[model samples]
Target: MARTPFDAGAEFDRQVRVLTDLGYPELSGLGPERFGALVAPLRARAMAAQESRYEPGAGAGDEGRVPFLLVVSRNVAPIEETMPRTVLHGGRLPGFVDRTFEPGSLERFVATEETLLPDPDAYLLFDIERGEEFCGVVPRDAMKAIAGRDRTLLTIEEGIALVTHFPQVLVKNKCFSLGGSRCGDRRVPAIWISQKAPKLGWCWEGNPHTWLGMASAGTRTGGVA
Candidate 1:
């Protein structure tokens, strides 16, 4: 039998159950507010890091050294109110917003430093896979400028394209679940993304048996057959 295509919503539910089992009570009822709360701290951290790295002495070199916060939420319905306040609070950061599933609108949100932020050193990617499907296209002119540059921390897919043609650089994949909710016995699959690697990984929680049985059993491949 052939493998099934990944269902973003179903995977989101699976992650919700994992959080519930881990005693995250709020995750059992995850809503927009809950998702916001989960991501706020991360946004703050990324912003603070960007501020720290910025210096007048660095000049144009500062452009390529900023870190980014990528957010991925699949099931939550898109609402203007659901837009992150943090982005607007201290001024918006150059990032993408995914409204791909919505009708009649552009699927992705692309912001350059001038349009979205005073400085485009860092990014806060909202809803990774959804953003990709919705608005992953970079304009041809922009692609021409940073074709083989190392300073840019492009999103996973973009990074893959750059790296495949130019294999001398490093790519990183930073994976984490944003938030989720459980329905029936199914847990929803949450969104995931990496800064460097092309692939994104998502799960409600780490598998219990894999950790407990394998580590405790003191074997490379643990558990009894």
Candidate 2:
């Protein structure tokens, strides 16, 4: 895929509008001004940053990936609520939660040791990949591989935010897992295509599906508002 030239400020503003339409301001309790400040650092980076070109031997996870993923922290935009809003196919396709994700299931899943939330309501993830390389790898092994490579896996909130903002990334047969958030059990959360709509479900940690890859990021950053 080609990286089209884009104006970062404009793109950032567009996403902000989309998020605002999603009613994130009320959810974050930041009204509008504080929410803007919460994500200012990300806008600053986006304005000055250029697209990522894979470094030599950087690995398959480096290419065709977004340079930064804007995340509304789970503290404010809870996954249970955000999951249903992960619209795809230009908002024509709706998102769903698997029935298996019963009450209290999401509460058990928190950020892993490596997944840090720098802000109370928002943050940015750099060098995020849908992890096309880790397809067919079980969640257990993929976690080790991500840690070994000095990368961090995407949390459930991050996964939801990614597709919420960049729906084009969640295509059929190429869906990714959220190994960074766990319930201290074998289940790993993921977003995949179901009935032509995106759905949030869980796959066993030891199970490997040819269609499921792990999502990851280079690092995370955010600020206090």
- TM-scores for the candidates: 0.23, 0.86
Model 1 residue 225 CA deviation in Å: 34
Candidate 1 overall lDDT versus native:
0.25
Model 1 lDDT tens row, 108-162? 3232232222222212322111112111222222223323331222332222211
- Point out where model 2 deviates above 4 Å: 1-4, 48-64
lDDT values for all models: 0.25, 0.78
- What RMSD does each model have against the real structure? 21.0, 3.8
Q: Any runs in candidate 1 off by more than 4 Å, and if so which?
A: 1-29, 47-51, 56-138, 151-225
Best by lDDT: 2
lDDT of 2 by residue, 1-225 (tens): 654455556666777887888888877788888877777777876555444433322322234377666788778777767777777755576688889988878788888777876665677777788987888998889989999999999988888878887888888778999998888888999999997778989999999999999999897776432
